[model samples]
Target chain A: MLKDGRVFVIPCSGIGKALGTVGRAAMYEVVEKLRPNEATTICLPLLTIGDEAVLKLARNNPCISVDGCPFQCARKNIEASKGKLVASFMVTDVLRENKDLKPKAVTELDPKGLKLASILAEKLATQIDEINNNNR
Target chain B: MAIVKDKVGVVSCSGEDLPEGTISRIATRIVLEKLRPNDTVTICLPLFLAGSEDERAFARVFPTIAIDGCDKRCAEVGTKKYSGKPVATIVVSEIMQKYPYLKAKSRGKLSAKEKELALKVAEEIAAKVDEVLERKKRGDSN
Candidate 1:
């Protein structure tokens, strides 16, 4: 099992657009900064390829997928890998909610992009806390 | 160097099926995180393949280096298909051929040999970045 009863985070390994980077930045914030003890991450591509250890972890732990677009590659891969997805987030939804934050540059996010990532991270953190509380 | 305005885009086939794929990802990270942090930016392969106009647009504007793990050349082919042809391409399998002693034990974790291979590939990528930047500078000057 994962240490500290943390949730697994799967970010869409979508490198194509600013939204994809936003999803990845938000996932990093949730896993490495905001909820370091409460969340971990599995590479989405590895899960797709059926990595045994990642599959086992997914089967055992609840996961949250952060997808860049509507396709929800992270969510689909998690389901395909036999992992339980407790909650999911979409960068497009976040952008829709926060219309002011128009991120520029797919590879290098501008300041607005970082702000958007933080906002999404905070939302994800709340969802993770809710899952933990319910489990407890 | 007169403050190059654009950074090189680094796209790797972060394929999970093979150890070479893992090597490609690790090596890309080395370039992004350690080697040429300011000179290169990573473009996600999945999004690029899945029709992200933003990624395709960025590749068209910036010089891109596609790093492939295997002979399938998914990264190279995908970049060329969606965006323009990459400025340079690096295949991990070709790198492996050059350094047969370095081997990756698993797709999930990098063995010592794999780490070495990743470092070697990263250095090569860094060199490529310099070469691309040099070409760009020359083109701009001309």
Candidate 2:
């Protein structure tokens, strides 16, 4: 385990839309690429199941919720588990801003979907830094 | 309320740690979108376990097919916990056992082999959907 103070990036695994897959891809980009040391993720389903270790990790650190739809399952799960949410993103809202990016597939992202995820990942990385600055 | 006669709830676990988890998710989408578009609706597992009353209600009332990635079976467990027992459960690991060559490695993007495996799994889920729907009179679409 990397030392304490990592942000938990919770992405909604909503299978209904391509946007949710984009959110998941964006999450992987943030934790695995953009801010590897600063951010980590636990499956949202694990948090909902009250997995003790996952709950501890979530509760101990700041969380960023990336939800695909308005239902906001990721954010609500964090709140339900009493995890601190430092930032929340709606993939639909992001797509609105970057209208050129279109995610077409749910299984694996197409070129445009990967681009959208990168955009979202870059935004989350920036926010994590800003949050760190504020905390300091 | 009563179980919806026409629709089945498909709850697929989102297991991020393993590639099988990814297969479970992608396969679910294929079944919902490509294979059984009109007959199945997705029940987001995260929302379901997070005490979304509507999700719970749907699983409780509708014929639910829980698709899980690993032996842990989060989807099956969650559906059984909040709602009634799922009408059926599909585990990807078990399915993988039947065809060893269809192994998937990446969680982010699927290879062609992985896509084929996902299609096979999707077909399995679609079959289950048809079974639960009791569609003996109707012809299978794909």
Candidate 3:
């Protein structure tokens, strides 16, 4: 049961490019489409932890860390900030669900990744809704 | 006198966000500011952990930057985890701590001051990167 309605969708900034076609697609579908009005999607090169805008949002809302890989930088960053993370997702987790995606190594940005991202986004949205409902 | 090779990496750890006045980005921008277009840099992040090959190629080509939002160093640690040697590390807390009002109103976005801070941090990083490059050149000369 969570009281906060915010979703923090963070992807490990640069590495996501490797998701190539699939990764790009996922970014557009999930981040562009499902990122809640109350939420924001942040992307930066591996360096530059959020400047001020990121801190403001993180300090107030429940966080959702999305990593393109297992390192889970997005999730780890939140935890390090001493903020509570309400949810989490990984790009690999999405890839796991769609075994047939066969992601390429070069990371050109693909629609398959977008489709997977959409699916993952939908899953997270549902989870958030459930949590929000439970809190009520 | 310096025993450790001055390695630097830029990162943005703004917890679930694209850090605007991000020191890491600013630092990167500064470092690359003078670099020729043929000179490429490798941007490493925790997200690319699975892309081992890509990571290697990136590191092999350019210096690394690690930008951390909070104290966690998500970007820094990720770079190290993948064996990408980061010469410099920047934390967002350091910036926000110095300027508490940046968080005022809790809009969850970067303020103007924050951007200024990020660029400053970026410049600092650029300086460090130049220092390391010089050292590497010296080492090569020797």
| Top candidate by DockQ | 2
User: What is the C-alpha lDDT profile of model 3 across A42-83, one tens digit per residue?
Assistant: 443332334455566566666566666555655676666555
Model 3 per-residue lDDT tens digits across residues B1-142: 1323344334333333334323444344444443321232445454444444744444434455565665657666656665555656766567567666654221122356655665566555556566656767687521
How do all models score by TM-score? 0.58, 0.88, 0.50
lDDT string for model 1 (A24-73, tens) is: 77877787689889887765654644557768888889999888878787
Residue B120 lDDT in model 3? 62
Off by over 4 Å in 1: A1-4, B1-142
**What is the C-alpha lDDT profile of model 2 across B1-142, one tens digit per residue?**
7777788889988887678888999999898878999999887887775545766787767778999888878888877877768878999999998889999787877889999999999999999988988842353322
Worst 10 residues of 1 chain A by lDDT: A42-51
Measured against the native two-chain assembly using Cα atoms, what DockQ does each of the candidate structures obtain, in the order listed? Answer: 0.11, 0.53, 0.17
The lowest-lDDT stretch of 10 consecutive residues in candidate 1 chain B is B46-55
**Candidate 2: C-alpha lDDT:** 0.84
TM-scores of chain A across the candidates, in order, are 0.95, 0.95, 0.70
